[model samples]
Target: MRLGRVTLALLAAGLLAGFGSALAVCLCGYGDGLFTTNTSITIDGVMADWATVLLDTDNSSCDGAAPGIPPQPDRDDPVQSTGRDLLQFTYTWNGTHVQTLTGRAASSTNIQRFIYYADSDNDGLMETGERVIVAGWKGSNRRVDLYLGHYVASNPGGDPMLDINGYSDGYDLPGTIPDLSSTGTPDYSGDWGAVDGVSMEWEVPWADAVGAPGLGLAPGSAFTFHVSSTNSNPGAASFPDQVDDNMGGCGGGAATTQYAQLDFFPDRNLAAAAGTTVYAAHRVTNLGNGADLFDLTAGAPTGSHSPGVAFFRDVDRSGTWSGGDVALTNTGGGTAIDTGTMAAGDTLYILIQYSVAGGATGTATIIATARSGFDVNRTNIVTDTVTITPLPRSSAPARWPRPFRPRASTTRFASKTRVAASWMPARSRSPTGCRPRRRSLSVISADRDQARWPS
Candidate 1:
């Protein structure tokens, strides 16, 4: 079977007992933190089939100088060391299922339980979206038991351990009768003479055990793994697992590669009057694996308008600018805005303000681009078009009509009081007290030469 590249880091700790002897133990350390394999794994309790799997070896006093032979005395008896002395742990996926193997010291008891946690969301927190597998020995015959469940961090009443009959959020899986053989050689053999540790192996369905809804285990799927062991039944209400020696004593490593990603929202269109300001609401979310800054820039307007543009942070996330909103300064070219450090999964709301030119008319296309600061190659862009229409003009005529005479014996004149002008008819009383009314008009005689005065 072919193997992928592996990375390892060693972390060790020691516990002293009555004799004051320091017993070195391996804490959960990365050994080939993330890797893939195509080899088929059998669930029979054996170690030869796992010889090629990446080994996350734990620290053991058996590797120390003057180490005792098989059936070594409990180094931390009264100190309550781990109920099961975890010596080695590793796992691999073969397209359909995940196979795991664990090794314990020869003197370790069969009262052992293992919990495998999967952080499928990569948020660095345990929640319902994540998965956990609990496997342990049960009954007088030491029958192997298995379970599949999720962690509910918000439910204070929820139990971290799995129940044999199944819980509200978990399922009791059929047992695989794991192989517990005492023929596995220690990966970290020091002065110990031929110490064949106890080996246990099991397998679980990939879809049922490792994958969560909407988050399946696939190539490039970023996730994390952590394995722990206890001496009590996994279904017990209260487990007294040895914490000082084996709480996180095995298989804790991240299983993903780092990358950058971003998303921009709200590509829109708007309408505004000339010489007025209009704003567009936008939001950017960081979807990468680590903290990063983003560069926001506006493209030149494409159309009849050359509107002034600026950007501001919606500090309150209200989608509109307020007194608390802070204006962002241009980094260069008056088009680029800088976003401070943003952690993974963080989101920021922004307002793009456009000051329409006084003479601007017709539509203007504005493009906003957001690029990851850590990797310029990763970027997202949104577009907005503002339609500028001319304001309505007054319908009143530029000037008032001229006054005329009537053909009848009586003569009358018409004038606009708002015009403040003088007009005289051939035969009429002095035109006075002419006030502007809602309905005012001037009528002219049909024959200009034919005119008459009051008799």
Candidate 2:
């Protein structure tokens, strides 16, 4: 049907306006050979310094971390850097990408800035690392770059990687070993971050982070380790790049390089001390969605030149196991033995005896395998290191101070009143040191004319 002149005019105007809006969204067309740059653009409304998954537009289910993601290899354990702190990045991606990030905790716990994220691309958050190596590596500017941590390495690549075993025993977060949630002193700073750029967050139950009491990991139970990154857009082009001295998946605008490096290390090992046990917890967590525990195929990192690279397993359920590259039985669950296939949020604990073995000093390395599920190119091949002390000793005992224990049924008392009835050891101590002191009877509680010790 032929429209009137007025109607036609209005229709033409509306069509033209709609086209203009689409053109704006598409930035019209990129002039050939014109590589427009972005500082940190807003992606899906969020500013990203690099090609970070801005929004989960496809709603891809990173809902749960992949189950059975083996515990990280010792050398590959997530690193918490020193002197060099925080992770930073700068990015520019050609297309819109969807990224899923979550901070799942064991007990409805919430971490504020607890998990760090940044803006790297001008597309308003064009990229974000899967795990923050360092939080809020500060920088405000035109290039898409976010700061995380400082860099450290004397290697040839200059592109340094984190050394999980190289970190110092950082500040201790005091709390008792929690049943599910840790309120007691937990080595809170022990974190494993992934810069493979697949910045998805994994919320694991407390049970997974720690092993059951007593059933601590045995010496030398190895497990798989990994660091990976993924872009929701199948078309992202990225490769390994460094930001904030952190190495991650850097998008190359139409060149996405899905890569993973996996290796093996003990779930838990002894701290660098002799005669004293520093519970080194190496837990293999399930990073997949399914609820079954899969067998961890053990591969000995055999090399002629690599000495002291011993592997062991407690095959008989006896408190002891042979120190070699294999174990007959894979202990899983319960106290004193937290090593096994875990359900979606479960973890297996493998303890290693990490001390100056054979009077050797320097570093130790162990390797494991990645059989299936995760992309081998993106989830296999990793490494970790255990350092030998600089102190010269013949298997000397290096121990932290022990906590004070109560004497057998000891009883003591204090009073404020003169001639007050009170009692304590004659060697009672005061700010001035153990001295003969006197107290007044008035300070004694009326309810307690006398009190009995817990007899």
Candidate 3:
């Protein structure tokens, strides 16, 4: 069961009363290529507040482009026409939510659909669970209809017409109904109504637009997104390119390439005896917008012990080494290893193993570092400490004296050797052939030994 869309129309109305006039007066049209805005926007089918937002202009003239199949006829004027010709598209974030506006060259009564595909995980492939927005306009209608839903197929390939499902209708937005009764026909039930003018505007919450938690878009986060205009024709119906051209299966068309963030976690401390080995587990994640490789390096240990350090990829994330775990070789000196390639939002478990030398003692400090393979400047580091102690030593003598003979005569023999007092027997002969009548033995001095005989 899918949840209904939370409408913010009342909230937006209140904000408009306070900030609408100021925004309209203060904001000048934005420069080309600018995509963000800080001003408040009202979704009243008017684009005055969006003046400061940049425009993503599509190929206006019909030049028989390869991707735009059937070649959009030269209906490049927004004031007149009957066909759906997308001229420009743009969107802006006002801190709380996003407002998207699209312009068309034709204003005559006709059916037009604007589709937005969001790659929330930024993995370059369209998988299930990512959101898509469809804004539809019929003839001469004042308001636009917005439908919110997620891709349903394992691999949607960026086609909303084929893969969108379980989507619910919002405030004036209508749910998409398939025209199963007839093939290759426009689903009129999916149309929201006609636009009052040449442009259409819609709003989406920030959380709902970006996607699931932890993978949401933030500052410096990069991801691929696709926007297209369609007239419901088969195969080559979309403008700016065919629906299947440069699709998610082909890595999508527009992706940002600046961010290459790597996250390393869980600094560790371990204890081990001399001549033993110990391991510390860790995890590294790629938080950027695209797939990237990371270089792993384990610094040489510092302190009393010079333990050998090795790195491994914990394939199962079991925290223990197993057959499936791969040993990372030293691509550079001093336990440096490579992480191959990791996709955006993907995490890899790692293990740092230390081999303690037989005579090693005290503490050894090992530093683990991860550097982005794409950008050397982007790196993360963590440390692991190993406390090594020597094995305990035995103080008891290696051998014990034989049983002594009892005698009536008293003879005492003293020596500098320190022996266990409990090992001495009463009225017995010493190991050196001296006999004692009683167990009263006293030390004369620290450096002196004496012998006494009594009959």
Using lDDT as the measure, the top candidate is 3
Q: State the lDDT of candidate 3 residue by residue for 1-455, as single tens digits.
A: 12322233433333223222211111112123224456676776555565434221221111111223332211212212333544334455555565555554446465555666666656544456665565567646544555555544333353232223211110011122221123223222222222344556666665533332222455334444555455553222122232212111111123222357779988988889999988799999998656778888877778888888888889899998788988976543333477767777899898888898898878988888998875677889988999986667877676776565544444243545343322233443455554533443455544433422222
**Per-residue accuracy of model 1 over 1-455 as CA lDDT, tens digit each:** 12333222111112211111111232233333334355655664433444334332322112111123222222222223333544444456666666665544443335456665666655444455466666553323324555555554434333332233212111112122122212222111112111232455566655542232222555344444445555644433343233222222222122233357889988979888988998899998988766667889889999888778888999999887688988876443333577777777899889999999787789999998998775677889999999987678877676644354333222334421132223333343435323322322243453433333324
Which stretches in model 3 have alpha-carbon errors above 4 Å? 1-113, 118-143, 146-200, 203-224, 230-253, 256-263, 271-276, 284-295, 300-306, 313-349, 357-364, 370-379, 387-391, 397-455
lDDT comparison, 1 vs 3, better candidate: 3
Evaluated against the true structure, the overall lDDT of model 2 is: 0.26
Candidate 2's residue-wise lDDT over 67-141, tens digit each? 233221111123232212211112222232212222111111121122222221111121222112212111111
All models: lDDT? 0.51, 0.26, 0.52
TM-score, candidate number 3: 0.44
Models ranked on lDDT: 3, 1, 2
Can you rank all candidates by TM-score, best first?
Answer: 3, 1, 2
Q: What are the per-model C-alpha RMSD values against the true structure?
A: 15.3, 31.2, 13.8
Scanning candidate 3 in windows of ten residues, the lowest lDDT window is 166-175
